[model samples]
Target: MASDLNIARHGPQDGPPILLIHGAWHGAWCWDGLAPLLAAAGFRVLAPDLRGHGESPGRKHLRWTGIRQHVRDISALITGLDQPPIVIAHSMGGFIAQHLMARGVPMRGVAMLAALPHTGALPIALKTLWHHPRTFARILTRLSLYPMVADPADAARLFLDPATPAPEANRFHAKLQDESFRAFLDMVALALPGKPARPYPALVLAGADDALFPPKAEQRLARRLATTAQVLPGAPHDLMLSPHTETTARHILDWAATLPPGAKPPATAQTAPQT
Candidate 1:
């Protein structure tokens, strides 16, 4: 992230603060629906556009950035705050959040949404080719498998139920933007920082239909995090954009309800909840 990384905020200034970090190829707009929902709960929300995306400053010059770099930016933002806020990271952001806590940042709580937990590296072919000028030029000319960045129809069909209209997908797709090769390199490398995993209350959430990290994968990851995991049936990877997000948020908020800004995590989440 650049020195001018942006973490836009909303809601009451003194209310409990929650930071929502987006995943790859996504920006703060990813929380368009969820932010307002969090606000309605009388909570303050800060959704940052990481290094290369959204209105944030450093797009073209983020060559050196990887997962550790991004986590540093988030940690800096958290430290600058008047209070230690609960950090809720989604997908790749989940990895970043865990790394931040490991580095000894004062954290209220950490929640992972469909996060990647395995430390195994990305495919040799992908790691080698992600940033090749010729490779990216060729790949950019085509579609990506992730619906959040590419196909709106696919995104809608996957995220929404059969009753949802196409316009909803179009609206969501309008927020889509390009991601950096460096970001891919980071996740692929699993270069995120590591610690002995001081057990903070963690929540693992997923969508049953998430092609990226399906239910089984989420289960495996929860085991790694030593936390209980849940997947909303028929939901896709973009659970926040899904109609089920409010419910998912409440599931988390329910756990959040028991703890204050500086208090320890809930007993239910202190250890691992039943599967």
Candidate 2:
């Protein structure tokens, strides 16, 4: 059965559609800063809370599911669109995007921000822990066995810029949810498939100071996808909610403008919910 995902939409009804996928521990709410900017640029943006995150209502079963389930949910949403939508994914969401493209989902283009490379998140996590074992040890102790939510301070340290306001960081941390352990394992176990026969345009963006997927890692991912990696100076892993949100949004707008047109679904009468 297809899970009913909670979607947040923005922009004109007839405008080109773009789908924003959030990363681990985040829901559709993470796109709050970027969605309006894209909409104002004359594009319809759709950000959906993946199953078990935000208002999607599958939290109880999340521990047993993997990335494939998320791929299935997103595929269904895209299949329902008027035309293939451009995809912008972040963190683990980037991993999801890669799989979608590999499966031949018709996307006009894809933009990955601080995304987990095809190399997967496990290696990155292990590397980061190796460099800062004590810090991660403390963070790990706070996580529950099943659905694990990192402590707010740990999340802030790993994802926010040092200059970010305390309140803003707190707000972002408060929205963090538990991620699926099975999904994490799946990401580590899954291997990247050969490059797509019909390659689509791709953009890779990294936070210069991202503790998770650093610039070098993102660059490697770009190389694999045949695209260059762009870096947001001093930003952290969660670029969408960071101080550089506008700058990141602008870059996405510019890249999205260059893609060739594809399927565009007509505007619906349903109004976007308040953010």
Candidate 3:
């Protein structure tokens, strides 16, 4: 199952690998903009769709998939890498990464972008219920997570800057799909991955105007990582898709540069084999 994961690769294959993990309802497509930016900076990038998302298989079984399975799937990918790759995770992807860290998965470092806090996602769920009661109701009634972002306006308002043009927001919404109800419960504390097995370099970042997770949440996550959060002004939940993407990429690059040497590019660069 892990070998079958749909992975999008970029940059020089032998260059140090960096894995990009997207949040709930999102897939590797969310990193389409940022992956190239990182790749151009001399790092190989691998973005894999979690099971039931994007081009990954098992969409019909999404309802049964949970964060635990996601952790295993991703951990397998990391183990298969030529070397431990730096991990970049967003939103719920960040949550899954936490589980990996707690379980001692090998990685050079991690940068959590607008990730869920260790405290759990109950607050986020409550906020969603308050702001989008109809959508929330639909989610419960349908036993699926797609209702939360099924509407373009709702998706834009929840995940993008308010100033984003409607058409662009709609296009973004179009790419979103159903997420697992069990995964949402896992995030809300069916289990908490706790802190990392040991301290490793980490960076936490968030958007100031993000409607879902706030700067404070990022700060809490940073504290857990023994780091501080960087809150970008006017940014939204989807920093990779927002106008702040370049800035976000720059920050990640700068952080990666400061890390103790990890994976190194081969003398002759080549693209990695597709997963």
Candidate 4:
């Protein structure tokens, strides 16, 4: 059965819980150092590897599954939590967070870090990378890529900070693999809601140099929500592993501090869904 695939974790036992979902080509391991930092700020943290990522089982061969399934998997886990925890999503995980709360919800808030709002339009670079023959062959071969692109150096530059201690990015890259195509399909299919969509008290962050979620998507989402969005200038896609990782984490902690309680229902923001 599909479920939230968990990875490493560290934080307070009884403090407010923050559910962290990672992006494509990454797992909860990406949150390794950040989890403890957040925990020090007094929060319980759950960092789960999305299915078919990290050490999770490969869903590549499955008959049929998509982003909706991933969101449902995440929602089911949150429902079982002692409280409706705040969601800390990165990249693709941010998309999941929004989908989770498209309708009113019992969520605290969403902190979307370097995330994609809707899968409708990712950058041309990402589309090229995903569709490349070498990359496509890797996906076709094992429904994974870690083994195929075992370049720790490139992984560090593209996905983590070149300044990050060698081990962090190396270890993460060694664990990389093919993600389920269903997930990408679902991301592209995320139709805006018909009823007024939920106004997630969300934080849409971006790395100035983030080639994936460039300035365009970030500001657009912020403008749509009419909330201030923060951009980490000079940072790359691996903003977490870069020098600003700690700073970014601190910023999120500070923002989450001002959030309303988890029981309050989500507010409506987006316009009516198409017929």
User: Order of candidates by TM-score, top first?
Assistant: 3, 2, 4, 1
Estimate, for each residue in 1-275, the C-alpha lDDT of model 3 and write its tens digit: 48888999999998999999999989999999999999999998999999989999989899989898888889878877787899999999999889888877778999999998888889978988897788789889988998888878878877988888878888888899989999988888797776688788998999999888999888988988999999999999998876888999999999999998876434453322221
lDDT of 2 at 108: 90
Better of 3 and 4 by lDDT: 3
Which segments of model 3 are wrong by more than 4 Å? 263-275
Q: Candidate 2: misplaced stretches above 4 Å?
A: 1-3, 128-149, 191-194, 264-275
Give the per-residue lDDT digits (tens) of candidate 1, residues 161-238: 554567766776776665555556566663645652466666788888775666777787677767778878877777
Clashing pairs in 3: 13-270
Q: What is the lDDT of residue 157 in candidate 2?
A: 74
Instruction: Using lDDT, rank the candidates from best to worst.
Output: 3, 2, 1, 4
Superposition error at 21 for model 1 (Å): 0.3
Per-residue lDDT value at 247 in model 4: 81
Q: Put down candidate 2 lDDT per residue, 1-275, tens digits, no spaces.
A: 23389999999978888999999989999999899989999988999999988999789887766788888888778867788888999998998888887777768999999998887777755864787676456545633222233466767777888887888878877888777767766776754434554588999999999978889999999998898999888889988875788999989988987888785545542211111
Clashes of 2: 2
- Candidate 4's displacement at residue 238, Å, is 2.7
Q: List the residue pairs that clash in candidate 4.
A: 5-49, 144-178, 145-177, 145-178, 194-273, 199-267
Per-model TM-score, in order, reads 0.80, 0.88, 0.93, 0.80
Q: If both were scored by lDDT, which would come out higher, candidate 1 or candidate 3? A: 3
CA lDDT scores, all candidates in order: 0.68, 0.81, 0.87, 0.67
